[model samples]
Target: MASREFKDHYREQRIFVNRTIAAVLVVFMMICVLAARYYYLQVVQHDVFSTLSDRNRMQLQPITPTRGLIYDRNGVLLADNQPTFSLTIVKERVSDMEETLTSLSDLIEITPEDLASFEKRLYQRRRSYESVTLKTRLTEDEIARIAVNRHLLSGVEVEAELIRYYPQGEDFAHMLGYVGRISEQELKNVDPANYSGTQYYGKLGVEGHYEELLHGKAGFQTVETDVRGRVLRVLEKVAPAPGADISLHIDTELQKVAVQALGERKGAVVAIDPSTGGILALVSTPSFDPNLFVTGIDTASYQALQSSPAIPLFNRALRGQYPPGSTIKPFIGLAGLDTEKVNTGTTVWDPGYYQLKGDDRKYRDWKRQGHGWVDLKAAIAESCDVYFYDLGYRMGVDPMFDYMYRFGFGQLTAYDIDNAREGILPSKEWKRGMKGLPWFPGDSINMSIGQGFMLTTPLQLATGAAVLANRGKWVAPRLIRTINEVEVTDVPSPEDVKVNQEWYWDYIIKAMEEVMHGRHGTARGSARGAEYRMAGKTGTAQVIGIKQGERYDADAIAEEYRDHGLYIGFAPVNNPRIALAVVVENGGGGSSAAAPVARKVFDAYLVGSTQLQAAN
Candidate 1:
């Protein structure tokens, strides 16, 4: 309908004005809503949004500190760090792990062991977004291949890191130990924050004993990154503190000489500096290269080491327990003299065999016809079994056990070395506990001869010899000479083995001298042409027991069943400088097999010390 009147036209104009006002109001409300939303985002949650945005472009990375240097006493490097490249993978960045691994294999030679080790680390508890090492010690060609195929590999990165290297190789394998990748069990015990950037840890020997001082503190750096997660620029940085430098008391030249002396023999040698109680040389023959273990030994090589009959990986010097045999005669003689069970003039008549009061079992002596009318000195020098048999029978087991215990037998030496075994020192109570058997007279006799139910480690033997050399002073053996130019002086000292007569030590020392220089001495042949006077004792440990009426036939028995030869000695009787113990597995005689080895060690240490003193 058309409103022709003036009032109707005015109403239409009013209606048009109202419609315009409504449209304007609607526009103004929408503007207000938009302004409120902007204010909420920019002001209310501004800090939270800003932080999230920055996180996408910035990252915190851990910096591994340099592992400390290891050196011999003379500054020869033992353990070192070498720059090497490794292939790493970030799980979060990879879409398909298996597919990515397969693709990466084409670019680099990825072994099955690498994949297995990577998969093992993948399931282990680790930080999110952290990269995992897939293959370590990457070659230059492999690194170039990966760099060329960078676009094809999304989660992969070629990272450079320091790897552990052993310069001395097998020479210090057991003593220096070797570092390897952090084990799952070790990771559980280590501090997560401190070990975040660290990979390897000490597995054995001194390296294991000083792991804390060797593994340095970890540092961190804040860096700017692009959308692709590549570092753009450094924002802030914190430098890590390097590990403390360690210096061992080991002499490299002496170690070489000892190894050379033990050539072609399956045995162990341990030499110590008597004055400072520092370990000079520790050699276990048929040693394997520790470098192989550091970079992860291959399955075949590791299996070969584990399965070999020679057992090259065994740390015989620290862990092997052998029957002490006749090498214990000097200590037993001292025990006899100290206890007054026998005096210097006391004598025993031997007829090649000994018998207990009523027992018909005749214990045969090593000599078919024994040394007649032997005194304490002659018994020790001649290695007369019958003389000790009578003395041991008279002293019984308790006194012998007490005396041997004072000499550090049957218990851990408590030395600075790791994994030092406490060899068996049989006692009445021990027998009851171990074998559920009562103490017998035959057991005492056997023990006095250092046979049957009694055992000792080469370290224990050497330490015992050092105690004798020190004239009853108990100085614990140590490996670390100093740390970072500061001498290590907190070594524990055991109480002295006080004797009723101090001169008894001199008497025993004089008798030991005879074992090397005397015309009738057991080891006199090996001690020939020596420029310096030395005190020594030789031992033959029986491997197989003969029947009551049968004689030992080495030719009839297997080589493994042959007797183990042992020798213990200290140099320059007037002023002792070195004490040593040598054990040759399946070697026939102590004088022929083990004593010759000691002669070489003595020559090396004594002569070398003189030369060193002259040079200084």
Candidate 2:
């Protein structure tokens, strides 16, 4: 109202026109900016957004390969596979982990142990979107229950998987071993990609040795999944390759015989085919059922095995380190002949005991009143310790250690034998290093008798006997005969023992034969009425050391403190076929306790062969 008096009509018209032009220009710029943004989002970043959208529905899943089958030489199925259903959960698909587990418990029996194990693996290293097992071996009723409540539960599914099953149960557990849940420590070592969907792997024995060959390649499938993580339909599929089937050198017939021979006693027995250097039988008594360990063993059960007085978990054939006792006499005899320390005519007078020149300690023999005049042959045949005691004292510890090491003692016997122990072969240097003491002549005497620090496994003794049977030709022992029906005898070239005289082999072998056939032979009772000739040696090792003058009375001491009986033998002395080593824990004597087991094994294997040849 105040400016009305000075009104300029032309100027106002110009101002109105300028304002309309500026408004139109601003509207045009805003429309261009919006159009450019729309184009960039739709055309340039199209694939990126499409992938994010597809991720909500599509998923990649891993397929576990079929594990290999295990068999004995006679085509007996040792390890098998059975279909099983397990409760599994994918954490990413779940909303509340605690709530889901609680709800699942209402649907099925979720044991405290199950919840604990699931919680433990919740944070373990795993592939993206991989399912964690909550419980295994779901029953049919549980499956039905889960299906009925599927709509309410998220990230839960019943997965069908193949579980390891043992057809022979406990008979071949230690040899074949069992698969178990992947431990957290083991997970750190294995390739995560290779074990994508796999839960169990070999934990011991042959299974562990051949894990790569047994666990086949993993495959994958791209599939459409629902919001709850249930597979709707497969978009793409890649089938996994099955593992190779393997056949071991073990004979089911011979293995059974070995187990039966041991009876209820806790012992170990190993039998080898001298010709092929094949392991025919391996037996460890008080064996546990392998199936119990395949899928995670419970804490209580595991603790029981770990705490048992018998130590059933231990693999004695490959790992038990015990004194060879008098069974080493034959090998000592061979060492003596090879070293020129003693010959066939070399004889030592035994007046019940042996004595070092300056020492008053009496190293007594099995016979209180020993053989009056004992040569190398009589020494071996009668298991005379006094005669060898003098020979070993003269030969010294290092010399015997070298010879014994060559026979696979104090060293792993075979390349493929998993965890085969290298038993102790005591020497002057060993005594100083291990015990911080100088070697003495009495120490040599004890070493000669396979006592003191000298130790050997049953497998080593059997391997040694096989070498003797082969007449110094060494063939590295093998467990597997074939893989996928193809020969897998990947044995290294053996170093055949070349002695000073080839006749030395025959002389020692002949002396061993007398131990089974001669009237005064230590193992004569066990070899009575044998159709074919055989060579053998007996051994008895003390569990508790006897004092300098104390005589061992088995009746007075506890049974657990009794001597461990041992024997090494082979059948058909001239054309040796089967060589074996037997160890009977807490057994009174080798001749009575261990030799009989070897005899039965020999009769079963050799007699069957004889009958088969006659029939053919």
Candidate 3:
């Protein structure tokens, strides 16, 4: 038995065979597992893996559409798009932001303001991968320098883009407004999908009012990029739809004439086409260049504009609320005729002042020795305050408010542009609401002369004059004449201001005509040597309150406190074509300062029309 156990070679061979079988089974199991994983990755999840890989190498980039071109009615370019270079940075790609900014500062002339603005925008940015503009309107030399050092500067890029440009500069600043870097608030309001690549947005005027139409639909492109996120090639692209080119009712020639006419003065002039209610010219002097605002205006420049006494940024035409003065006389006269409170033949005795039934307060007239015994026609033509004061007392505040409201007063007249003020047409209700006081007979007296609580913007006055010129047919004023070659006819129609006597319009219009052509016309000097007949009314709005029986002494008052000169007029009285309103801030009188401005605008339009007619 011992000899048998020592020689057991078969047993050893059996053990070796079992070990070999176990090793083979383990190797086969591992191979099957590896094959299953390969199948899952290559076939089952192919699309998922492919997308992840593509995301790493390819980028979907937004292509900004070119902003619309703005042109005057005569095809004069007001706003245009110009090619500009901008330096941008992506925070995610950058190794160190401060280091990158420092390096860029060394390469280019980066002001402290630029750095501050950039840092602000960097914090405000939505994403780390999105490029933030560091500096705009980069020079050629700056671009070349950045390109040479591109390898060292990781997230920095110089991109060429189209920026808004105002060719008319300061002249059209307020009317066309200006585009500026999108603010944090603006970003919240804007459609992220549409404005992904757009950096600038309209801040004011027509630019703001028609921002949707001006900012075209954005497009996209698939770009092949390297590991460093540098674009290697544009794999596919979808061209962006350019913004609609807009044509305004503004006549550049007329605008220039109006601007020139208002030279060196703090004033506003608004001219409209009576037939179409198209704004021909809108001028607010002491204007600053809109170009300054396009690419983030520097603090110093902005401060200068903000702090200047002239108020260059103020849109006086649409926002300045001043007493209508004598300008509202014609409208008041219309109201009188409509209510039967006073007819065309109604007369009142004038002794240079008006008293409300035994009250000591004597509302003085512009003429110290007023036109003796004035009727409605002579009252408006001579601007006799006594007659209107009596008229206002008779009609009271309710009827006056009603009639004025009908003429687009105490409300927005031009719906086309944004920020137009609805001037105050002081009524008993308005006085109670605003000043918390009862409407007195004296209040009515003041309202009658276009004084106490009676306010009107230059735009409103022009719109009212147009209404009068159109013989009570109201047409809301508009700036946009056409959009993308299609004429815009969606302007709001005027409400019918019906009167008891239809001939009342003609009667008041004839009285206004006398104010321009009659011997005793208030604006007689302004109408001298006119080619065609014009209807007009002169006004002097007091800047400061005058005491009872106290004469308005211009020399005693501060320059800013001097009376504002105002005039409302329409040319070719028989068939009115142009209706205009002029206001000179701190000007001594309407006839001297404001009427001349109206004359210049009238001459430019009427003479130009005559020339065009002869040419045809």
Candidate 4:
């Protein structure tokens, strides 16, 4: 009241007008700020937001490429790709993983094992949105059932993928190992981007060795999806590149024959072309079906294989290590000649046993009543243990190792023979280093006959045989003749074995020929009536060492503990075509068990029954 009494009307009005103007300006500033923000969002950052929205609306899917076909040299299919339906769950797309897994069980037969494997994959999974396989190799009826219930299934997909198949399952099981789901451990070693959409990878054998060439680049597809992340329709696609179709040097018919020849017996046979250095036939018995592992083997079946006494999973040809026995005699004989320790006229008095000049301990020959007098030729033909014993003792361990190594012993033999063992060629340094003991003279004597620490794979034996067939020339043994229809040209050439005297080759070969053709040859029985002149050496290796005064009766011992029969040979002594090695486990004699198999293999290749057709 007091203030009103003294107030001027114009002044009060002016103050009210000023406050109203201040309010108006504040509102205008806010409007400007809002307009600026709207302009920036709509125009400047437009592409970024739109792209993010599209990413949510359209999903990128993976298109697995069709796996490459694997064929034998004769155009016979070894590995193939088959169309199979798999019921899979994308964890991020699924509303509830466990519930969907249960729901899918109703449409098809889902065993407890399937659930267990699914859980294992989840634990091993690396990336998100990756499909978890619930059931694979689905039947047509099961696929139809899943398709009919598609609307109810949110994250589940019925993907038809090309899986690895082996028509020649048993024959090529170990040769071309099957693909399997990539494990976390395996995934770590691979390029994650390349393996994206590809669930399986090469697990073992040739498949494992050439995984890079066999597994092609994965492709991408832009797919439209609903709000629930369900794929609606494909918008765009990048086609997957299929893996290379490779042709192995494996001769299909010869492989079949080798398998048939080895039937039910646990062993290995490897045949090679001496001129080409191509592995004509590589066979290992007690083989499994490669198809069994293609779709992930069942637990019971896998366990059965694991528990099998025969070890069907083992690759005997390339991996099995056994005492080479008399198969090594020819190499040692050659060493003797080259070192000038012995000559063509070299003769040894064999009274069925050998001894050090001062020691009395007898190293007995195979024949108790031994050949009285054996020269180089007779020694090799008769497989005279005493003669080799004498030769080896004089040659010493160093020269033996050097000579054997030149023939590809104690080392891997081939450029393409993957995972093959190099076998043991014992020497003074090796014995001192590995066994922490001095090399005994007795070790030399034993190694001379391919005993003691000496060991060899069937493959190495075959390679050595081929080298011998080549007359001191070295040709690297290999399984791959061509890749993707192109000849494998990158393989390294091995230097020919050094020979001081070139004639030494012919002399050693003549002795080997005598083993198959001579009257008292050990393998004469196996070589009877052969159309072509052949050269061979038979071997009998003891599994368990026989103590002094103890005798080895093959029938008296356990089958696994008996001798391993081995044979190395080549046909048509002059122009050797096929060189091979055969091993028969617990078999009595090389002539009876392994040599006959070699003879059969030689005849199969030389008889001209199966011709090599132009590789398709």
Question: In model 2, what are the clashing residue pairs, if there are any?
Answer: none
Residues 1-616 of candidate 2 have per-residue lDDT tens digits of 5655777999999999999999988998888888888878888878988887778888878999999998887778988889999999988888898888888889889887788888887788888889999999999999999999988888888989999999987889888889988878888888887788888899887788888888888899999976666779999999988888998888877888899999988899999888888898888887898999886778898899999999998988988888899999988899999999998899999999998777788999989988999999999999899998999988998779888877888877685679888888888888899999999888889888889988889999999989888988888888888899998766883688778999998898888899999989999999898999999999999889988778899999999999999999898987888899999989878999999999999888888665323321
User: TM-scores for all candidates?
Assistant: 0.94, 0.94, 0.94, 0.93
User: Higher-lDDT candidate among 2 and 4?
Assistant: 2
Global lDDT of each model? 0.88, 0.88, 0.89, 0.87
The order by descending lDDT is: 3, 1, 2, 4
Q: Evaluate candidate 2 by giving its C-alpha RMSD to the native, one decimal.
A: 2.6
lDDT per residue as tens, model 4, 198-301: 78889887788878888888888998888767778999999889888888878888888889888888899999888888888889989999888876888899
Tell me the TM-score of model 2: 0.94
In model 1, how many backbone clashes occur?
A: 0
Off by over 4 Å in 4: 1-40, 123-128, 228-233, 612-616
TM-score of 1: 0.94
Give candidate 3 misplaced runs (Cα > 4 Å): 1-40, 125-128, 609-616
RMSD each, Å: 3.1, 2.6, 2.8, 3.2
Return the top candidate by lDDT: 3
Q: Predictions ranked by TM-score, top down?
A: 2, 3, 1, 4
